[model samples]
Target: MPSIMQRLNLRPIVLAPMAGGPGTPELAAAVSHAGGLGSLGAAYLTPAQILEAGAAVRRLTRGPFAVNLFAPQPSVQPTELEVEQATAELAPFHSDLGLPPPALTTQADIDFGAQLDAVLELRPAVLSFTFGRLTARQMEALRERGILVIGTATGLEEARQLEADGVDATVVQGGAAGGHRGGWLEDELADTLALTRAAAGSVRTPLIAAGGLMTAGDVRAVLEAGASLAQCGTAFLRATEAGTSAPYRAALAAAKAGDTVLTRAFSGRTARGLRNAVTEGIGQPLPYPFQNALTRPMRAAGAAAGRADVLSLWAGEGVAQGQEGSAAQILDGLWP
Candidate 1:
């Protein structure tokens, strides 16, 4: 079988999917057209939206691209007491943002099976997932349809597991990675360089290094250490094509290397973003989709008002390296 890079004919760069907003069809196509594997972070999109986004990318680029989703995990519905506590905690922020109280009745209906079916129908060059792994049947189905399956990992064990489970490639997400940490089985954090080196030594499958990689040197180091490609998210946040909101883009531009922290305040899941009032105040959040849903209104308001403090300003530790330009320009600068 061809290697993942060979199959996609991609360069040593992959656009890490930034779900929620930053990942857009135009951004994906621009990067793919520039020879890297651009990815759609379809984790937050409905099945119909996923198909539409794939079509939109197809219309822009004939080059190979990938669509990423969060593997379906069992939903954790907050109890009344839990909901009350979370609501009370967020009430002040809601008031500050001039938003109404969150409706706890709204459940996160993320149908992974339906999303997968849509992906099969769209037939993008690659199908990648994080948060968790897919079942054997799902993997077989993807393989039968000729879709390359890529899994995300944060440690050697996870990489080994993905390889054993028959993933075509594994993105070794280091501690510096922005957004959610893909360490589903373990909580211990490992730096990107260390994790990539360790996973490369252990797993035969191609390793794609992710996390604080922001420059050509960063990409070269990972490739030398054995990564087949470098997957970058924060490095492209300032790219003109990214759908990053105005405030989030400003935060990325002004952010220093250590301004980000991994907090569950915004989404219940441990995701890294800029340190702000919301992150500093909240301690124990409800749970993944529940916490994510609870804070949606405030985040939306923050975005609309360009309030950086209340928004989930997701970015990696290498955010300082982010530059403003078209996606193609950013890719050229990173590789050149």
Candidate 2:
């Protein structure tokens, strides 16, 4: 089989899949149409939603694109005491937003098996995952269908493991990356360039560098460091076709240096984003899915009402460099 790079026939840029509303089919298709490998973040989407989204992207462009999901994690639930404490902490924020007390355990996890089945049916050019590696059987199924698989890594060890697991490519997500930190291994997070170089030297897999990549220079630097492609998220947050809300777009435009910080307040996972009331207020979040569910109502309300304070404004360290434009324009700017 030809490699993922050959199958994609892509430019040097890959669009980082911005889940939780920012990543739209139109945005993904637009980037793909512009010669970059666009991505739809399908972590929270139901199987039907994923199929509909994949069809929507197909309607927009014939270019190759990727659909991404968070690898399945073992089921865990917050204790009743943890839920009560978290709810109590979130009470004021809810009241301020004219909402009821946060329902800490109301949200249920998406069924990953169904999600995978939907992806196999959609048969996109690429399937990528983060948080953890896929089971060997899952990997074999993707390979059987001629679908390329990519896994996320935050350090050399993760990259090595992803290669060993038979991923077609590994996205080396450094510390400067936006959204959820995808590294599940114990190794420390390295900068994009450093990790890319280290992984390039250690593994045979093709590398896609992600993190703090705002301009063409950043993309070029990562490629020079041994990445075959550079993936960008924050740089496209303001892309015209993205589903990023009005308040979020405003927050991105107004963000200053040091405004973005890694916080677990929103999703219980350590993710990079702009500092706001939620980040400043929450002491400790329960954990992924639990914290993610606990804040869903507030975030949805904040998004609906154009309030930036309560929403998860996930961004990277390069928030200052994000510019407004079409997805094509954004990709053009990032491609050297």
Clashing residue pairs found in predicted model 1: none
TM-score, structure 2 vs. true = 0.97
* lDDT assessment of candidate 2: 0.89
Structure candidate 2, residue pairs in collision: none
Clashes of each: 0, 0
Candidate 2 wrongly placed segments (more than 4 Å): none
RMSD of 1: 1.2
Worst 10 residues of 2 by lDDT: 1-10
Clashes counted in candidate 1 amount to: 0
Error of 1 at 268 (Å): 0.5
Q: Locate the minimum summed-lDDT window of 10 residues in model 1.
A: 1-10
- The estimated TM-scores of all candidates read 0.97, 0.97
